[model samples]
Target: MLRYGLVVFIALLLSGCEMFGKKDIRLPIDVVSLQYDPYNYSMAELDRNATAACIAKGGTEAVAVDNEINTESVRWAYMNFNCYR
Candidate 1:
C-alpha cells in the first residue's frame, strides 16, 4: 500500500509539470494580412508580394498562413513569419 501511494504521488507530480510548465511561454509569430483583386493578380503573385512585405518588415522567413477569396469580389492572403537578428 505504501509503494502504491508513492507511485501515485510521483505520477501526479509529473503530470502537474506537464500541465503548468508551458505557461506564458510561446514562440513569436509575425502575421501579415493583405487584400488584392484576383482580376489583377494571381495567387503566386500575391504570395510573392506578401513574402516581400514580411521581409521588408525584418522577418527572416515568410510562409502563407491562410487565404480567402470572395469569388465575386476580392482575394485575401495571410502570411506568418519569424524575425531574426
Candidate 2:
C-alpha cells in the first residue's frame, strides 16, 4: 500500500508540466464580462463597449464575442471575453 501511494505521488510529480521543477509561474489573464439587457443593447454595441473596456483595462486588442437574444422577452447576451497583458 505504501509503495502504491509513493508511486502515485511520483506519477503526479513526473506528470506535472513545469519549469525549474520548483514554483509554478502562472500568467495572469484579464477576463472581462460585458453584460446587457435585451432590447436595451445590441450585440454589436455591447461588443464595442467590451472592446473599449478591454482597451481601458490594458488588455490585448484581441476580442471574441457571441450574439444571443431571447425569443419571448427582451434580447440579452452575457458577453464574456478576456485579454492577455
Best by lDDT: 2
Q: lDDT for model 2, please.
A: 0.66
* TM per prediction: 0.43, 0.43
lDDT by residue (4-80, candidate 2, tens digit) is 99999988887784533667443536767776675565757766776777778886553554545574674655667
Clashes of 2: 1
Please provide, for model 1 over 15-74, each residue's C-alpha lDDT reduced to its tens digit, 9 standing for 90 to 100. Answer: 998988856543435666666655576767766776776678776545665455566653
Give model 1's clash tally: 0
**Steric clash pairs (candidate 1):** none
Number of the predicted model whose TM-score against the real structure is largest: 1
Candidate lDDT values, in order: 0.62, 0.66
